[model samples]
Target: MNQSLNRIAAMTARYYYILRSSWLRLLEIVYWPAMQMMVWGFLYTYLYQSRSAMADTAGLLLGAVLLWDVLFRGQLGFTFTFLEEIWSRNLANLMMSPLKPAELAASLMLMSLIRLLIGTIPVTLLTLLLFGFNIYALGPGLLVFFLNLVLTGWAIGLVVAGLVIRQGLGAESLAYSIMIVLLPLCCVYYPVEALPLWLHPVAWSLTPTYVFEGMRAMLIHGVFRTDLMIACLALNAVYLGIGFTTFVLLLQSARHKGGLLTMGE
Candidate 1:
């Protein structure tokens, strides 16, 4: 067990070192979030000009875009970090060691957080300068939403990572497609009521739905829903449990079938 832990530490340090050495990696992380903020900032400004009634939603959509990126970065961070092992054809080596799946999952979560912080902080800062909107104004609520978003990302990422292990790179699209499917239902830029009445149940059942709804309530109505925050935390717990369990099972299946040894090829 101690040897496995040591190996995990070495693997983490190697990846961290790679990140530190790669200036392009840093720039790539900064690029997309900044790009999104620019596009959305212009859109928000245009809406404020074109529709007097839309003026009240100045930072609402922009804020959602920023917050949603947290979740996006988190999931991608976790999955891509895991896939790095495969792309380097090192996953089989790790699996051949005493390293356990749970340990690997936990490490991936930590690395995801590191990448998320690195990716989003600059974009958040830039959004403030570009739009004069400070997401930090959400105060402690900002932290709440951030945690839930990352956890939700990890949940999705775990499932993606597991599937890739089971079915190879062909299943890789699940990483982005699954999140895209949830985008409309997440109530990111609009309230859940904007969806059809029939889809309301499905939307509300998602953790991010409460997150965006609560964000809107706070920003627009100055009303913070403790209920929504509580709901997100509760649902995240359940979803994360399911995601982790599925990952472990899928990984075991892959190992038994010897797919891990040949995944990157």
Candidate 2:
């Protein structure tokens, strides 16, 4: 236990030093999310005041955007942790260490949480102070909704990380592009019913769809949908399992193919 904790600490320190040294990186953590909140917050305000059909427009749209970032930042955090090691040419060194793969994963998960907090907290607070919109108004269900989104994000990040492991830097773009591709299917600013009839099933298969749906339900209807939460949790479990397995298998494949050594080159 002590060894695992030490490994996690060491890995944390590794990224901590990188973040500490780069002011631009720190700015990036806060900038994009804040910008997104500001733009969406205004649109939400407009809708709230002008749209008679949509009563809870502010809560619904703001909640969806904030919650969606939890997933986006979470995935980016996880992928960037791995990408950092690769970019710094430290993957080989880490692989040679006594650090186990599970420990590495735990450390990356911790880093993901750190990154998520750094990125989202400011935007959340700004939305509250500036727009008088508090996502926490969703109440205790917000906790469950957050967990579901972060877990799904981590699952997607792991899958992308796995691909990078197997394909080297050639697959690194997945870190940025995968989530965007998934954005439409996630039904972030809209509802699943808004999608084309054929895409409804595809949207439902992704866990974030249910999470955003549940968020809207809580805001608009004042009822927490336990069924959507259940479905989201179940789907997340399956995806997480597949993601972790794929990451491990790809890591081994990289090892055998000498891909790790060339990763930095």
CA displacement after TM-score superposition, residue 181 of candidate 1 (Å): 0.4
| Tens-place lDDT digits, model 1, residues 169-203 | 99887776778888988889889889999999999
Candidate 2 lDDT by residue in tens digits, 218-265: 877899999999989999999988889888998998888877876868
lDDT of model 1, residue 158 = 93
Which runs of model 1 end up more than 4 angstroms from their true locations?
A: 1-8, 49-51
| Cα-lDDT of candidate 2 | 0.88
Residue 192 deviation, candidate 2, in Å?
2.1
The per-residue C-alpha lDDT of model 1 at residue 118 equals 90
lDDT of each: 0.88, 0.88
Q: What lDDT score is found at residue 114 in candidate 2?
A: 91
lDDT, model 1, position 182: 87
- Worst 10-residue lDDT window for candidate 2 reads 51-60
